[model samples]
Target: MMTFKFARPLAWLLLAFIIFVTVSPIGERPNTVTMVDVDRAVAYLLLGFAFALAYPKQWKMVAMLLIVGAFAIEYLQYFSPTRHPRLHDAGIKAMGAALGLLAGWVINRWRETKAPNGLPFAER
Candidate 1:
């Protein structure tokens, strides 16, 4: 399957961002103008997507790590003076990560099915 040259590096960058965001004070966080839940979900979604693409052969492990990392993010927030951790929030993040992983799976499947003759898999 075709893979992006920088997928792994991007994933690492995202992981670092996630940690930074979690630890930073609430007032320091960027204003996305969206609901906090939406922000949390989308962040984890992107993180999972990167990891999935970075490690195409390890999607299952990526799913597990991302989910665990979601909960871990919440747990980390508890140590932050201005942040609070919530199970509901973690759940949302986990769901988003799952969706992201599914997206990566779809992309990989599509690329793998590309025909040798430069046509769609079905046309081959």
Candidate 2:
């Protein structure tokens, strides 16, 4: 059975992280590598992984949340005078979420396979 005792707190933390990323302006003038877009994407990916790990049985819901959240954030950027929403950014976010989901599934499968008498892992 999945544990809920710690999931609530973790969820809140993840939500905070998402909000921070969504609200904060990234990539300064000229869009130099120092701005670190890759790092930001990885951060979002980790956030997705956290959600997936906390709710493995609800993978569809997790995926939906990630996708919707990414879209919402990008939409919100449209309102910011300092930032403009870009389809490319949304695409990158989606890619990150997908990778995170894949990582989460791999981890879960590994755990399941390690369990006594559990079914062997099979690529799907």
Candidate 3:
């Protein structure tokens, strides 16, 4: 018999949200409740968290993917009429990703210590 894995749905949703926000016009975004740098970091932080949790064993690959993705998205923004690519934004994203990865590591450790379980989420 074969089983299916339906874990990490939140991660999938996070990826979709990231793509949408990245490509959308800057003017269309909601009024900022925080600084731009902080917003960018928070966005990428969640992205990194989702990815790290989804692929716990492949953190290095996740880091590379996140870095490449940050660059790719910024590059795409260069061509958008209302958006500009900035290295500082990318740096913020990298920092956020690092923090998120660290958080994910901590969560994984806690889960392991408490449950000694193979998977973080139960199979559905």
TM-score of each: 0.87, 0.73, 0.80
Over 4 Å off, model 2: 3-8, 25-35, 117-124
Q: Write the per-residue lDDT of candidate 2 for residues 1-124, one digit (tens) a residue.
A: 5433565477559667666556566553233355456755775687677777777677788888887888787788766667777877777777787788778777866766676655443321
lDDT of the structure predicted as candidate 1: 0.82
Ordered by TM-score, highest first, the candidates read 1, 3, 2
Each prediction's RMSD over C-alphas, in Å, is 4.0, 5.0, 4.3
Superposed Cα deviation of residue 96, candidate 1 (Å): 0.9
lDDT of 2: 0.68
Task: Put down candidate 3 lDDT per residue, 1-124, tens digits, no spaces.
Answer: 1111332677678767776677679877666669988888988898888777777667788888887787787777867788888888778888888788778767755655565455443231
Which candidate, 1 or 3, would have the higher lDDT against the true structure? 1
Clashing pairs in 1: none
Highest lDDT, which number? 1
Measured with C-alpha atoms, the lDDT of residue 91 in candidate 3 is 85
lDDT of each: 0.82, 0.68, 0.72
Instruction: Assess candidate 3 and give its lDDT.
Output: 0.72
